[model samples]
Target: MTVTLAQAINRGIHDAMEADDRVLMFGEDVGKLGGVFRVTDTLQETFGTDRVYDTPLAESGIIGTAIGLAMYGFRPVAEMQFDGFAYPAFEQFTSHLAKMRNRSRGRVKLPVTVRIPFGGGIGAVEHHSESPETYWAHTAGLKVVSPGTVADGYAMTRAAIAADDPVIVLEPKRRYWMKDDLELPVTTEPLHKAVVRRPGTDVTVVAYGPMLKTAMEAADAAEEEGWSLEVVDLRSLSPIDTDTLVASLQRTGRMVVVHEAAQSLGPAAEIAARMQQEAFYHLEAPILRATGYDTPYPPAMLEEFWLPDVDRILDRVEEALDY
Candidate 1:
């Protein structure tokens, strides 16, 4: 059955709650309000207020307490109302939840899933459009992932809940309304690997979150101009799907890394570095980057220039091919 990406998340969590009595969720207004974006609508009622409850607006406290609950054998799913609000919990996440099992020499485990609604496009005020994936990806012990499609939204949520380690799942806020008949087999692909959304031969465009949709659109725009673009949705960000990325670059000999993060030290930089190390000889040009400028995400009025649109991606593509 076809469903919007947002609905998939709603249904998927419902399934997870039914599948495991130990699963619980906590966040700001996740109870009666179902979250700031309504992703958790009705979750509290169905799961009972005890299983799905709201917590104080302190991110650190939410995560720190969730870690303890995890130690007690409860699967905790913590939600950050917005991407920018996750900073306060960073210390607790990296220091405790991420290191519990390793510190115990594998004696104990922390099973936690943190759902963050992120990325731009809805056009809101400050602190609403920040992309902080790099900060968490830089963390050592946490598994970071994002879902670009309804199918992935469901599968990744389920997989994260079952993992005995802490996982951060960033849901592209701009894509909640996007829907599709993602009836693909459940076992078709690994949640931690990259997925090829489009096949091509000219160049490889690596993107994640909402940028995945933009990359697909860019591929279509270039198709008429005789350029074939292989669009790869980097589903898993932390343990990057480097193997898939390297193989694709080896074949294309050109690459364009796109993301909504600032240019310096962004995911694009990491990808560019890897491609250079693994496929420098095979490259036809320098790895082109189409990224958010090295400035804070501006007001919605200026985001068109900040976020890489089709024009931006294709402009870089031209430079790469012309090189």
Candidate 2:
């Protein structure tokens, strides 16, 4: 029950593979290398090479093959080597996999999951730490989900594998090693529900994936400064859990959306618009967003200034409280 975020994800994938004979996993370095982070190690030995294997250095081929496999009644889980690498597969995803269900008039479904390691931290090189969840979420037929905790990572993988639609699982690469104390039997929730990570009446800090940890840290730091900050992990990014967030905003009267993606038309923009439409009268100040710079993720040295951290989140929280 007590596992690091990375182990939880690995265990989740193993569970899905064991439960379904039709489930297959393929990605660069996945079979022999066990993934660049060792998340898929030992899978090929356990599941057989046919079920777990590696692909060439082509993102489009990975996705295109996965789509074909899904059409043949297999649930394919394809991993994009890095956030930037997924760009080449966008056509296959948005044009083919994402539209299959709708294009088939709901007669056929593409039960495939695309796993992309995204977001910055750990002093990563360029493209390895890019946050590109917004791009996938923008696709209509794709269901986008990001895990903010070990339990979410485990449960959502199972849920996504079972769904009858294409799903994009965005793993926060930076939080892969962040250890935590998990409960036995696993604290589980719906795949589309937002989790109230920290409860307070003052203000709500909404984040998913990597930014949830920062928001929680900011909440802890804010407590020391006598500000009770509520942190909500927006688990489902595309079909966002607006009902849960609307309740939080009504109670807190202020909201801050935090993410590592650029500020424009990102998840924050969608959440802010939802909040403004649903809880306009309850808000004490305009919904705020604490996110990465509009520019690309900088080098290891400058990424510190670009990514949203505890200090930056707290600064925005204070500004919202003042307003």
Best by TM-score: 2
Cα lDDT tens digits for candidate 2, 1-323: 56888788778889899989999999999998899987787999999999999999999999999988999999998899789889999899889988988988998888999888888887987778888888888899999999999888778877888888899999988888878765644558888889898899899999999888889899999999999998999999878999999999999999999999999998999999999999999999999989998997899999888889998898889899999
| Model 1 residue-pair collision total | 0
Candidate 1 residues 148-234, lDDT tens each?
888888888888888887899999998998988756445536768998888889989999888999999999999988899999899
* Candidate 2 lDDT trough over 10 residues, lowest sum: 178-187
TM-score, per-candidate, Cα-based: 0.97, 0.98
- Alpha-carbon RMSD of each model: 1.3, 1.1
Candidate 2 clashing pairs?
A: none
Candidate 1 residue pairs in backbone clash: none
Cα miss at 166, model 2 (Å)?
0.7
Alpha-carbon shift of residue 106 in model 2 (angstroms): 1.2
